[model samples]
Target chain A: MKSLARRLVLAVPLLWLLAFFVAPFAIVLKLSLSRAAMARPPYEPVFNLSDGFWGLVESARQFTFDSYSLLLSDWLYLDVYVSSLRIAGLATLIALLIGYPLALAMSRAPAHWRPILIVLAIAPFWTSFLVRVYAWIVILKDEGLLNHALLGMGLIAEPLRIFATEGAVLIGLVYAYLPFTVLPIFNALDKQDSALVEAAMDLGATKTSAFWSVTFPLSLPGLYAGALLMFIPAMGEFVIPDLLGGSNDLMIGRLLWAEFFSNRDWPMASAAAIVLLGLLLAPLLLFERAQSREADT
Target chain B: MPRIGASGFAALLLGFAFLYAPIGLLAIYSFNASKLVTVWGGFSTKWYWALLDNRLLLESLWVSLRVAFASASIATVLGSLAALVLARHGRFRGRTLFGAMIYAPLVMPEIVLGIALLLLFVALGLERGLLSIIIAHATLGMCFVAVLVHVRVKMLDRSLEDAAHDLGAGPFTVFFTITLPLIAPALLAGFLLAFTISLDDFVLASFLSGPGSTTLPMRVYAQVRLGVTPEVNAVSTLLLAFVGLVLLTGAAIAQRMRAV
Candidate 1:
């Protein structure tokens, strides 16, 4: 009875997840393998639906590799995926470059000031994310603040076209996600054993050397955590590219959005999504190890 | 490390400026007297006053408020239960899998999930509207709550729950009376995060929202897409203030919890 009660406690969440989370994704996965039969409002699938035991129904389709084959054929789709990957990769590296030093400073600050630092790191999140991105549009436009300031300072005679450029998208991506990197790096730094650094110093190692040997390597847990957090989202980012990039047609997310909403190719969208989900599955498996380290202290 | 060189100070100042300039310009231009948003015009509160009379903006904000309040509350309750089970129980069959699934929604791209959920809704003949959006928000916000509550549960001493059970309180009562009070800060944090996400959600709202069911972010996004306006600035300032207030409340809750 006791074990049964405990099982009930566990089963509630488990079943809820299966029904809503796993089942939906499975349906999508199944659909990814099947072709869409373009019918009227109630579009039919090219699959026979038969009731299975346990009150579940399985789709009966002469499963073929056709959807996968169709998805891989177009060089247009491949190019978009590669472009998005490159951008997200660079954005992740840029976030690290900015975030690491900032986190180091925050971690070394007096204990009394730590909360203040944390609040600042989190303050940006409080604002609406879309508004924050929209704010960039105002400042990066040709006659916007950045160009106007440059002009007024006599550095440039004319306004700069900072908006609708790849650089603009990068700036938006970095600015939008800086805090994610900051928090993770800060957490790693906060948990550092100062004693090790002191020992390295006492052994006559220089401060920089000690940081390189003792501090830097030890903080990889948080840094890795942050990179995964930021990079994964950046990979599939739709809003930044859609709003900031003049060349929006070069992103997988944009393509997927177009395929589903604009082209009305449901099977194509599902195939694209399945591929993206496969990309995500790599980091997601790694996230557990990161979480345990984060949760400790 | 405490005192930086001039170059360090300059770099810090530059970073801060980079962070603040965009939003600051938007805030300042909200009060600009001219119709052209980018032009440096005279100062006025015309947009703020105009926003007050905007029926579309007001209606959307009201819809957003109702949805956020409903979704956040539901997510917090269910998420708390899940968190308590995960953090306290520690091990069950498929515990690792369970934990991963709970947080999968956190990292899953909203565009992907929105499309998936839309498909599910379509397949079910469930029309797109407030109901669909609420469930979507709840699914997402539940992850934040679970993570937050899990953190709090990990931090708790835990022996108190055992003591309560030994004193004859059943599992349900022990949870309600003892465990709940201990982890209240996390629960509060979870609710605030959920509420804010639901309030600020745009991408999912755009996908799933029915006609006239647009949320505040959707409203702002639409207005901004048409072009920059002073009304957007005024509305953003209000949003900033409301977010500031919520953060303060969340901080106060954390402090009060720590004190106890």
Candidate 2:
């Protein structure tokens, strides 16, 4: 009975994930190898269980690499992939720069104030993400507040064309992801022994040198965690780019969206998704390792 | 703790300003009388009033709310169970795989999950609608719930549970009597987090929602795509307010529980 209860406990959530999470990936992989068709589901090689075992074998034989080959051959796909990487990379770096200082300050805050500071740091994240991104639209437009402020200050003669540009997308990505980076970094920095920094300073290292040699090095784990958190999702970010980016320079996320929704090409979208997942595998693995290490320590 | 230097303090202020300015601007502008989002007009509640009468927006909001509540409830249950598996069930078979599956969704791109689930539904001949969306969201949210609840579970005093068992309490009885109340705050936090995630989601809803199932985010995205409008601003402001209230309450509860 005890063994049965243990099995029951594990089986419930595990079965749910297997059915909903893992099974979907298997379906996507199979779909990516199938052809696009004008059917209700819009993909070929559909296995009809009613047709029995022979039909299943026949359908399996119909799988093709056409979708993947198309993706590889097209310069559009290649360009979007590269640009997505570049944009996600640049955004992660920018977020790190902005997040690091804030996290450091937050960690250095009075003990009584740390919880409030932490809440403040993460408060924006709990708000509607779309609303926050939409806020940028109102600010970055030609007749927007940002231009108005700049124009009022005589900073620029004309309204800067920031909206629907790569710059705007970068801003949105960094803004949306900043909290993710900050929390991990703050946790890392806050948990470290302050005595080490004091020891470095007592040994005659200047504050800046001591920070670089001791504090920063100690925060590497957090840095990696934060970067992975930011980079992985930013790479596949659709809403930010679709809303803020130019029509011509599509990210892979936007491209995949168009493939599935606008073009109704399930196979193509699945192929793009497969590639995107492949790209994220290394970082995801690193994150898992980092998480387990953190758990251990 | 070390003192935050002047420059670090300045950076903190600026960073927060950057983080908050957009949403703050949206809330402030929601009352702008003029349709032009940037232009300052006399303050009015016209947009808020307009939101009340807009049937499409109202319908979507209802759909979103129902979806959020249902999915969050389901996620909370499954996720709590998963948390127990991770924190209480020591070194179960396939534990590494279980851990990976739970964490993967947290970091995986939304678009990937959206499309993957969409395809799965299509393959299984399931209609895309509220039911589909709830399942997709629950799948996504359960991981977050598990992660959140796992923290509280790890911090639990095992001796209390052992004592309950020693005094002739069954596993279920001990779980219900001792463990459930102890982890209630984290469970509440997880539920709220899941609900917020479902409410704020667009990508999954976009792919999974069929006719008459448009979510508020989907509606807002469609509008925002066209251009900015005061009505969208009004809806966004309301959402921001609702989410902020929920989170602040959650934070307060968490803090209170920690103090105990």
Candidate 3:
């Protein structure tokens, strides 16, 4: 009875994941190989099983790589992919630059206040994400508070055009994902023993050298984790770019939305999504491998 | 730890300012009497009153709350079960695949997950509505719950469960009377985390929701795209307060659990 109960417990979640998680990817893959049409459902069904088992085999022959081919042939899709990577990459780098120091400071804070500092860092994340992005629109608009402050300080004679630009999108990305970047790095930094750094300093290493040699290397795992956390979502970000970015800043997320909704090309959109998944797979696998390694140790 | 250098202190100050300034500005402006978001007029509570009368916005908020509550509850159950299998049922078959399947949603792009699930629903002839949104939210949220519960499960002392088993208590009885109680805090944390994720979700809800079933984020997105208004600031401030309350309660519970 106990063994049966154990098997039942295992079976339920396994089946749930298989049906909900794994099967959907199969649908996406199948859809990517089908052709887009103007009819309902938009894409040609992959198989018609009603004609019997032989008919299923015959229907399989109808599958086409036309969507994939179109994606390959069009420089527009390729450019969107590249630009999305560039924007997300730049945002991740900037986040790392900003977040690393803040996390280091938090780690170096008085021990009694560490939890409060951590909570303060994470407080902003609890609010609605859309509201957070909307807050950016309020701050970056031409007649926005930023320009008002700059003008009042005589930093600029006129309001600078900061909104509806790639820079604004980058700012939004960094702001949205900053907590994600900081927490992991902070976790990594917090776990490191102070004794190691003190020992290095005792060996005649300066503070800066000690940090570089001892503290920084130990925090690499956190850095890597934070980078992946920020980079992955930043790549396929829809809301930030959609609201803050101008028409000129065409990331893959926007491109996919346009293809699926505007152009009504489900196959093309599925293909694009597949490619986006492919682009993200390497870093994701690396992260998973690192996590499993951590588990093993 | 070494004393933080001046530069480190400056960085923390600047970093925190960057994080909180926008949110602070939104909250402050929600009470603005003026129409424009930038031109801060004297304080007024009129937008809050206006929000009470906005039927569409109210309905969407209702939808969001219902979805969050339902999905979070369901995700907690399924996720805790999965975490239990992963933690206690050692070296199960297809364990690696199980781990990957559970964790994939955590890192998967929302757009990809949104579209993939949408496609799956359409293929299955399911109507897009609250039901679809709930299912999608549950699938996404369960992964988060799993991660949280899995960590807590790993940290649990095995001796108590072993002793219960040695006393001839059945596995089911041991799980119910001992294991469940010990992990209740994790279960609560997981539920709240999942609830927050579901409440804050926009992309998946937008993709899966039908014409009449817009969520709070989708409504806020539409309004914000049209133009910024103090009304949005009002709604956002209220949402912020709600989420802040939930998070504070979760933290307090966690702290008390630790104290015990």
Candidate 4:
């Protein structure tokens, strides 16, 4: 009876993930290789076991790399891929620059204040992500509050065109991902023994130099983890770019959305998704390694 | 342990200011009487009233709430089981694979998952609608719930359970009487997190939801894409306020659990 209960517990989530999560990837790969059909479901070689072995063979023969080749040969796809990497990279860097300091502050905060700071850091994250991004539209528009404040303060003569630009998307990306970047770094920094920094300082190193030599090196794992957390999602971020980006600022996510929804090309969209997943695997692996390293320490 | 100097403190203040500024402005503007969302004509509650009268928005809001409640419940059950497997049933076969499955969705791109699941639904000949959205959300949200609940489960005292077993209590009885109550806060946190994920989702739900099955975020996204309006601001403010209240309750629960 105990073994039955245990097996039931194990099998439920495992089988569900296999069916809902893992099987979908297999279906996506199959669809990516199949032909785009002008039908209700919009893909060809919809395989079934009713026709038996010959049907399987026939459907298997229809699989091709045409979509992938199109991705390679088309400059539009190439541009979108490059643009996505660039934007995500920039956003990650910006987030790191901003998040590192905030994390440092939180980590050094008094013990009673630490949890409050942590919660505050996580507050914006818990709010509606779409709402947060839309908040940017309210701030970055021509007559938006940001321009109003800047112009009133004599920072600019006229409103700067930030909305619907790559800049706007970058802001949205960094804002959305700031919590992911902050918490890991805070965990790393907070876990560091203060005695080590004191030891470095006592050994004739100045505060800044001691920080550079000892503290920064100890926090490398968290830095990598935080960067990956921000970069990976930002790479395939659909809503931010779709809402904030202008006509020419097409990212891979937006391109995939356009292809699938507007063009109704399922094969091409799946191929894009597959490639996007491929691009993320290395960073994802690095993130896992960083997390494990943090755990070990 | 005063690591931050005066300048560092100032920078920290600026950092938080940067974080909260947009949200602050958004909330303040939600009450703007102007149809032009940016212009501050005066303070009023008309937009809130306007939100009530917007039938499409109201329908989507209802859909979002229903989806959030159902998916969060399912995710909590599935996720609590997965968490048990991870935290309690150690050294099992294929444990690494199980852990990987739980962790992968936390980092995987929504678009990738969105398209993959859409294709899965299409292949399975399932109609895309409320049910599909719930399934997709539960799948995604369970990963988060598992992660959250796993942390609490790991931190749980095993001695109580062992003592219960020694006293002739079965696994089921110990779980219901002791384990469930002990980790109740984390379970609630996981549910709330899943609920928030389901409520806030746009991309995944957009892909799964069929015609006339628009979620609140989807409806808001469609409108916000056209331009910023006071109505979106009003709705967003309400969402922010609601989530804030939920988060505060979660925090209070955590604090109370810790105190005990």
- Candidate 4 Cα errors over 4 Å, as ranges: B253-260
Ranking by lDDT: 2, 4, 3, 1
Q: What tens-digit string does per-residue lDDT give for candidate 3 at B57-84?
A: 9999899999999999989998998999
DockQ score, prediction 1: 0.52
Give the TM-score, chain B only, in order for the candidates.
0.93, 0.95, 0.96, 0.96
lDDT tens per residue, model 4, A1-297: 999999999999999999999999999999899889988778888898898999999989989999999998999889999999999999999999999988888887778888888878888888889899999999998888889889999999999999989999999999999999999999989889999999999999998899899989999888888999899999989999888888889998999999999999999999999999899999988888777765776
Report the TM-score for the A-chain of model 4: 0.97
Error of 4 at A268 (Å): 0.7
Task: Write the residue-wise lDDT of candidate 1 on B1-260 in tens digits.
Answer: 46344544554455556666767777788778988777778989888899879999999999999999998997897788788778868676777787788888888888888878777776666788898788888888888898889888888887898898999988879878988888888899899999999999987787789877889998898777776666787898778778779978888879988797
Model 1 chain A: lowest-lDDT 10 consecutive positions: A40-49
Q: How well is candidate 3 docked (DockQ)?
A: 0.75
Query: C-alpha displacement of B167 in model 1, angstroms?
Result: 2.7
Candidate 2 docking classification: medium
B22 Cα displacement, candidate 3 (Å): 1.1
Q: Highest DockQ: which candidate?
A: 2
Error of 2 at A191 (Å): 1.9
RMSD of each: 2.8, 1.6, 1.6, 1.4
> Across residues A1-297, which tens digit of lDDT does each residue of candidate 1 receive?
666777776676667667567776876776676666666322335333344442233344444556678777878777877888888889999988888877877777767877977877877876778878888887888877678778888999889887888888889999888888889898888888889998999999998899899899999988998898788888888888888888653676777788878887777777788888888788877876777756674
lDDT of each: 0.80, 0.92, 0.89, 0.91
Give fnat (model 1): 0.35
